[model samples]
Target: MAAANGRPVAKRRVRLLGGLAVAALIAGLGVFWAVTAPRAVSAERLAAIEAIEADPARGERVFWAGGCASCHAEKEASGDDRKRLSGGLRLTSDFGTFVVPNISPHPDAGIGQWTLDQFSNAMLAGIAPGGSHLYPSFPYASYVRMSDQDIADLFAHIKTLPASDATHPDHELKFPFSWRRLLGGWKFLFFDDAPRTELADGDAQLQRGQYLVEGPGHCGECHTPRNLLGGLKTDQWLAGAPNPEGEGRVPNITPGSPSLKSWSAADIAYYLESGFTPDFDSVGGSMVAVQKNMAELPSADREAIAAYLKTVPAR
Candidate 1:
């Protein structure tokens, strides 16, 4: 009953408001569940890796291909000092600062206690040993494209690194971004294990380059511009992007850009090996770490990467 104007309240109005409230509650619960759920690798994929033995010798290639040393190794480390995996490198981004954790064999400070499946899950699915979501700063999005064997070999090689008992500092994030559960929703949208592009021409060398660049190398994560959600702009491919950590822009490596249009496949290979451009300029900036990793690869692999880069359509 309405007391103020001496009018009776409508029953239909009350029922309509009640129904709307119930609907809103249901919608909120659905969103909550979607963001909190844990997504992991398939059992079939796990069984595939489990079926074969890992080769640590070949695993060394996987390690360099993945560039584990660049992030996991000690900061300011040069020469043999790069071998120490006592993590302290700080990756500063707009959202927060992520401190790379020690991935060495130290039981308390690293992943020494982790099983191969746990490592595989972290690489492909971005899930941690405790079943929580890992930050995208780890670049698992591209790693999702890796084959089961490559993951196995990489894990084997990681085991061979010397142990470090370094302390791992937690990441500093702004409110809401600090929540790990929210990453499930982020993963649901951006995490696909499929290769970004398929080679219509079926060239073997180009295919190998595609595998290396799209999968473990994760070139697009740095070279391609990102959307507001931080997902790479696939249509643009390697057309260049701003450094999330600030400062200089990442160069466009796609074909026909003036900077690289004149360079032959041999020139690109030489740059990867020696860090020198055709103009005789040495590689600098964050690319320094990647060039070092590329130098570790065989001459054939460097040439293969160049061959693939030459064929990409200019933006």
Candidate 2:
């Protein structure tokens, strides 16, 4: 049998089967590519949103809350050294060693040229200026919860940091993980920019605490255990986990946990402010850096964090 324009047609059934297979293949490829494609923060949306004038003073507060200096400051730096945002810290993990990038104000080396919009994308959306996916190691996943005003202020504060010409080597990651584009696939599965928690109307202090705990503070990134794919187990929240960077265990902050059940909210606040456990033991490990950051916060903010933590369910 011959069709009007075809040389020959074996059978309509054969054609239908072949066409279906081709369609399925195309559909599969399309889905694969779509899931693998990296997404960027919408520049148009960023532009349309009204940003408050950034205040360097306010940004200093945000900087402390976000703990930017812990990672960006020179390794083993103390005192005045921490003010310099010349990143060279080496973070180790199962995936590989990540060499932190320079985030200083140096035009050639740092993010000096990055626009506010680009910084927002980097901090909140985990997208770089050139639209590359930043690893969750940078903790932008938690930063996503930060307010627009905070982001603006933080950016202004960062700009005021002294410029450094220091350069660091690229992240030394193993196969597949070393590929930056592969992060698109990871982002598809885990990256979410939505609000992590919701609070009732009013109660400004509690609300501020919630923002700090869930946002720039990024408490869960360390405290929450991760799934096999490296996504945080939100159900567990801050129930604690084995540290991926080392052998130490990340402590559970939820009040329900027997470990922290004895400690009152005031105890938590005091610890945050002074790095002294209820037992009067000094803080250590990765938390040392975090405690230093928390200490910089006002006593009110620290108390607010404690108040918010008390509201969380014990695991």
Candidate 3:
């Protein structure tokens, strides 16, 4: 009789322990969901962004400054064709191959239907219209620093571009990296919109340069080395990095860099405008496209970029 009673007690203990384990699992899942959920721009901020008037003419400047065509336009597109914005570029990285999507104004294949509010959210918060997180490969991380007016203007300019039905395959990422929801945690750790470098004395030219480089130009995205988690190493800002695409290295543009140490501010600006370095080496490789974009900008903007590069800490 005592053995029979002890068996029942043991069974009840097992049931209690199993229930506790299930409860703990549910709680853990709840925490994971909460942490990985996408966060859009707040309604109040969206309202302010909407209040700004958009100008396509001014946005054209932002377009060049941001180098949208470098990735969004066709790889072989040139001259007027560059305005098509039919994205088919393949960006290969350690994570996987990220095919650039069609950002043209087509209603279905492109973002033609995305409202200004949607665009603002995508640019500033890295959230998609359907409330999914966008992969940082889109460079919205750098765009997060853009001003509301600039974002509005960029949308207007993009709307004016010719629409394309061009489509590309979805990103091919490895397991775990393939999961989009996990990006929420990544953003929480490294999605900083703050200025990467603080200018001394708040000089106006340096400030403009900083805005162009950090906000729209996104030069550091390539120049700065990333951590194991793909976060930018702030300490090495604009110091050359291993080329994510291949074996070579992105040259260091900081003042202390040997390659650029002797380059005068004028030399830098002239190279950007003319695609010829101080030593008369014509721009080559991936920078060929970037130099072309820089040539289209006003001379003053290029000079501002040069002045800013000269001031950066030598890496």
Candidate 4:
């Protein structure tokens, strides 16, 4: 009884059922996420948002502070390594390796069309524009504190960047690790929706510096070692962590550490600028990548970051 193609109606029904089955499978996966995914904001995050006006104009600066572009961007072959913001960089880990996505302003490929709520959910909730969970590599836990206004502005600025349609490489995870649903349990244990604690006596500059380091710079994400479960070891904040990407462990940059005891905030500031320590030795590994972002920051802001680091409870 097929009228359109003159094919058997029974055959058409079978084809339609097959297609619907696949769609059902995908939709079921999405529903599983909707039920199991973590979603809870802590009180501390709220206080930080109250302090700042959420202006896209200012959000641009905060975006830079978070170093959103550095990890997201592809590294160039040149020694100086230009091409900021455009992403194709590969990040390797024991569980997997992920090539950064092209977060550029490409309308079809990038975040150009993402709604503000979508952007906020991505940053704060660790959920992509759809209800799907983003890989933890995005560090949404640290970014959860970003005010809605600031997130909105950051989204706007990202939309303005030149788009690169370079496709992102698939993450190569081992077994259950490759499964996104496996991350739901990991999130339950490690992900904190609480925003950062704002210092009342801390001046605006100090607060800004803190936000940059803890939120966007996500310096702690790498520098601060995590427990077996992947939560930052609260007792050993910023002491040092196993270098997931490199051979050697990430060294402690805290002032209390012997390596940094001789150095002043000014020295750290200079090192961040030149990628060279006071002893004229070059710093390497992921830090080199971070310095690339730091180098672009204003001197005063860099200084502010330096001053803040100097006070970080040593080791």
Candidate 5:
């Protein structure tokens, strides 16, 4: 059947037409999946849930160290008090805006029902529980280095958090970037299975920094730029990159990168504790939120992070 433009019309024409269109769309979707899903899973994918069920207490520590709650959960509860890992923090970027998802333990809306392997894949592989590639905004690149035992414990603690049944806002990304299936190609370009295998010798401070930046802190997720394929631009490591907040830059932290070099290790540590960078300028943007998390950590760990920063080769 056709509209008033004068095509033939029958009593059941609308129903048949709609059904055929849906069938075609479904066929197209099937084809799309056939092309996309295989690359999302790696042969090295983690094995089971039993691994993550150990040491809930230690997992809680890893959660804090990893700063999971800062990004996954809302900074403040909403009127409905439904902001625990239900997602929906809009992160604007040059390519697109992303809404962070709730990772709380809500059975229906959160990670409560995710199997251990599913959690492992998301953290280690940046693929969601269903084998779909997650946007790098989740920072699994840094997370991939995390020890399996630690990851498992982290998941255990996550299960104990208060659940929120809140629904999240859908991401309204722009063209090309909006095609989630294309993420497989993006993952191939940026994601890797090889974890950090070595650290700088003779520098305990540097090693600590390396662990914090690459693992729990995940600073590179925002501080590093992406190549054409959306992988972190390692050549420009920590040299400054655009952030979703206020279009402010994640300033270059490398020694001579025009941002952090002038500050002493003490300056860095104090700024972390009080949100005051050198020159008395207040830290802002993502760093503000980051400091909130850092302030909660022990003084020694924070200082260790500072020591590590000092060891970064001057740019």
Candidate 6:
């Protein structure tokens, strides 16, 4: 009888322990779901953006400043072909080879069905339609700094572009990196819309330059180094970084860097406009497309960009 009583006690203890273990697992999953959930812009803000009348003309300026064509256009696309946003460019990174998606106006393949509110949420919140998280490779991290009006205008301008049914392959990512839910943790740690560098005595031109660089131009995406998790190292803003695509490093543009220290603001402006450096070397590599887009901008915008670069903190 004593032996039988002890056996029952042991069985009850085992059952209690198993129940606790199951409870703990359920709680863990709940926490993970909460952390990884997509967060879109507040409905009130979305309403305000919807009310703003967008101008395609102003959006053209935002389009060039944002360098949308450089990544979205076909790899061999040139001249008027750049306007065809049938995304096929393959951007290789440490995480994976991200094939740019078709953002053209095609109702089926592109974002033609996306409303202005959806576009605003994607640009500012990194949330995609149907509540999926967009990978930061889209550079929504920097675009989050853009104004509502600019987002509105940009959507309008993009609509005017020719639509293409051209579809690209999905991103090829390694192991755990392929999981989109993990991106919420990454964004939680690194995504910030704050100004990268603060100007001491900011003027109108300096402010304009700052907006173009920090908001639309997204220069830091290339010039600034990133942490192991692919987060931008804000402490070393514009200090230069290893090129993610191929050989050599992206040049540092901060004042403390020896390469840019010698170039006057005027020289920088001229380089953007003419693609010729002070040494008469022409822009090459990925920057060639960037320079071409910069050349199309009004001279003042180029000057503003140059002026802003002169003020960023040295690495």
Q: List the residue pairs that clash in candidate 1.
A: none
TM-score of the candidate numbered 4? 0.77
Clash pairs detected, candidate 4: 45-195, 66-216
Two-way TM-score contest, 1 vs 3, winner = 1
lDDT of 3 by residue, 1-315 (tens): 889799989999999999999999999888878988888888988898889888999999999999999999988678978888899899998899999989899999999999998998888888889999999988888999999889999999999999999888899999899999999888988997888987887888888898899989999999899999999999999998999989899999999888989999999999999999888989877788788788889999999999999998888
Query: Per model, how many backbone clashes are there?
Result: 0, 1, 0, 2, 4, 0
What's the CA error at residue 179 for candidate 6, in Å?
A: 1.0
lDDT of 5 by residue, 88-184 (tens): 6778766678888778898888888998878877887777766667777788878887877888898877887789887787676889888777876
Using Cα atoms with residue i matched to residue i, what is each candidate's TM-score against the true structure?
0.93, 0.90, 0.93, 0.77, 0.78, 0.93
Global lDDT of each candidate: 0.85, 0.85, 0.90, 0.71, 0.71, 0.90
User: For candidate 1, lDDT tens digit of each residue in 57-158?
Assistant: 898888878877788887656666666778888998878899999989888898899988899899999999989999999999999988888999888888
Model 1, which residues run further than 4 Å from truth?
1-11
Please report how far candidate 3 places residue 68 from its true position, in Å: 0.7
lDDT of 6 by residue, 60-144 (tens): 8999999999899877568988888899888899998998999999999999999998999899989889888999999998999
- Candidate 1 global TM-score: 0.93
Model with the higher lDDT, candidate 2 or 4: 2
Q: What is the TM-score of candidate 6? A: 0.93
**Poorly placed runs, candidate 6 (over 4 Å):** 1-24
Which regions of candidate 3 deviate over 4 angstroms?
1-25
Q: Write the per-residue lDDT of candidate 2 for residues 1-315, one digit (tens) a residue.
A: 236635445566678899999999999889877876667667665764335777989999999999888899976677767779899889988789999999999998999999888898888788888877788899988998888888888889899999998888899998889888778778888888665555655688888898998899999998999987678888898999998778879999888877788989899999988989899998888888888889989999999999888887668
Candidate 4 C-alpha error for residue 228, in Å:
2.0
Output the TM-score of candidate 2: 0.90
Query: Compared to the true structure, candidate 3 yields what TM-score?
Result: 0.93
Model 6 lDDT, full chain set: 0.90
Q: Higher lDDT: candidate 4 or 6?
A: 6
Model 6 clash pairs?
none
